[model samples]
Target: MIKFDKVTKRYPGGHEALRSVTFEIAKGELVYITGHSGAGKSTLLKLIAAIERPTTGTVLLNNQNIGTLRRAALPYIRRNFGMIFQDHKLLYDRSAFDNVALPLAIDGVAGREAGKRVRAALDKVGLLNREKAMPIALSGGEQQRLAIARAIVSRPAVLVADEPTGNLDSNYAHDIMALFRSFNEVGVTVLVATHDAGNAEGRLLHLDHGALTEGVPA
Candidate 1:
C-alpha cells in the first residue's frame, strides 16, 4: 500500500540519491530491492518509511502523501512501520529482551502484554532463551536476529529492512530470509534492500545509478 511517483531525493549538497524513481509495494507482498552500492536502494527504503522526504514528486502510503506530512503527523505514520537498519541497532548495555521491549515501552503498552509480545517475537527469531544476553556476547548472526526481534515485537503491518543480511554468512542469510518469508505469509508487507536478491520470493526491483533499471514496479 505504498506508491512512489517520479520521486527524486536530493541531499543538501545537491547529490541526487534517487532519480525519478517510481514503484509500488502492495500490502502483504515481499519485495526485494537489488542494486550495487550507491544505487539508491537505501534511499528508496528511507523514502518509503518517510525518514527522508522526496525533493520532487510524491510518496504515497495508503493514498496519503507521507513525504509532505507535517512534523506532528510523522510519528503516527511511522508507527505502522518496523525498520531494520544495516547495522543491528541494539543497546549493548541492555539485555536482548530490553532492546525488544523498548518500542513497547515507548508506546505505553502495559508490562504484562508487552512481555508476552517480546517473548513471542524473540521466539520467532529463535532467540527466546537469549533474552537476557547482552549484545556484545552474541554472535553477529544472533545480533542481527535480535535486531529483527526488536523490530517485529511491535507487530507493525509493514517491515522495511536495509541490508538486514549484510553481515551474515550464506546460511545465516538464508535463515534470515526465511524469517522474513514467514512474516510475509502472515500478511506483513516486507521490503528488503540487499546486494544478493538471489531467487528471492516476491517482486524484484533493481536500481542503477539511482534509477530503476529492471524489475516490475508493484
Candidate 2:
C-alpha cells in the first residue's frame, strides 16, 4: 500500500530526479521498477522510504502521507517498511546474526524474542549456519542473503529492494528473485528496482526519465 501522487524530486542543484511521477501499489502485490542507470529508479525508492523528501506532491504509505511525517516521528513511519540496497550495507564488524538483529534492537525488542526472529530470518535466507560469520567471510551471494534477512527480520508490511542483485552472478541473481517471490507469496508487498532484464520476467514495470512506462501497473 504505497502511493505516489504527482511526485517530483529536485536536488539542491536544481537537477530533477523525478518529474510528476504518479503510481500506486496495492497490498500483497510484487512489482518491479526497472530502467537504465540515472533513470530515477533509486530516487523513487528513496522518496518512498522517506530518505529524501519530494520537491512536490505526496508519497503515501497505507493512507499516511510520508512527506508530512515530522522528523521525530519518521522512525515510526519507517518501521512499516523494509529496505535493501545494492551494496548489502552490512556491518563489517558485526556477525550475520547481529546484523539481522539490528532493526529489532533499535525498536527495543529484548533478547529472547529478538533472537528467535533473527534466527528465523537468517534461516529463511539459508544462512542459519553462518550466523556467526562476519560479512567479509561470506561470499557475495551469502552477504546479499544476509542483507535480505536483515531487511525482513522486522516483518515490515512492505519490502523495497534497490538493485539487490546488482553485484551477484546470474545464478545468485535468480536466487534473490526467487527469494523475493517467496516473500511476496507470503503476503509482503515487494517493490524492486532493477536494471537486469532477467529479473523483470514477472510483473515488469519500466521507467524512463523518471516516469513509469505505459501499461506498467504499480
Residue 74's lDDT within candidate 1 is 83
Per-residue CA lDDT of candidate 2, range 1-218, in tens?
78888899999998888988888888998888889988899998888887888889999887888788889888888887798987888999989999999999998886899999999999999999999999999999999999999999999999999998888889899889999999999999998989876636556667788777743443
Q: Mind giving the per-residue lDDT tens digits that candidate 1 earns over 37-80?
A: 89999999888887888999899999999766898898778778
Candidate 1: C-alpha RMSD to true structure equals 1.2
**Model 1, residue 21: displacement in angstroms?**
0.8
Best by lDDT: 1
- After TM-score superposition, the amount by which residue 48's alpha carbon in candidate 1 deviates from its true location, in angstroms, is 0.8
In order, the Cα lDDT scores of the candidates are: 0.90, 0.88
- What residue pairs are clashing in model 2? none
